[model samples]
Target: MVQLNLVKVLLLSNERTGDVRYEIFSKEGENPDYPEKIIVYREGNIGEHGERG
Candidate 1:
């Protein structure tokens, strides 16, 4: 099994939509358990019924 080492991480935000996107830096490889990019919504960004923009 190959292990990914954390090199750096950045949290970028979209001013227009107020959405936060995170970038994870690691040794490039396939990791089924984790994802490379992730987007998180602000407090009012997501709807009550789990809607997204």
Candidate 2:
């Protein structure tokens, strides 16, 4: 068995037409078969600034 520690997660964020998109990926060389670790989060009109959702 083997475990690859999540040393760091690179966050990529973008906002377009009031829509926010986020992508998460592990640092390079920290893990193999990285395509299996890609995560994407999406949201639309989450808030009106200074708000938490």
Candidate 3:
């Protein structure tokens, strides 16, 4: 039997807009399909600072 565990870390943060960024890492290189690290973004706003509808 084999087990896999993933770790997530906060890469970036924004206080004003409640935006966040995260990174996923495979410490043991468990999965061949994925690299050592993966990036993810969680946006609080629809557009960037200047862009608006």
Q: Each prediction's Cα RMSD?
A: 7.6, 5.1, 6.6
The CA lDDT at 38 in model 2 is 49
lDDT of 1 by residue, 1-53 (tens): 54555544555566445555444544457553465544443532566565566
What are the lDDT scores of the predictions, listed in order?
0.51, 0.46, 0.59
- Record all residue pairs in model 3 with backbone atoms less than 3 Å apart, i.e. clashing: none
Worst 10 residues of 1 by lDDT: 36-45
Q: Estimate each model's TM-score.
A: 0.36, 0.30, 0.37
TM-score of 2: 0.30
Better of 2 and 3 by TM-score: 3
lDDT, candidate 1, residue 17?
59
Q: Global lDDT for candidate 3?
A: 0.59
* Candidate 1 lDDT score relative to the true structure: 0.51
How displaced is residue 15 in candidate 2, in Å? 0.5
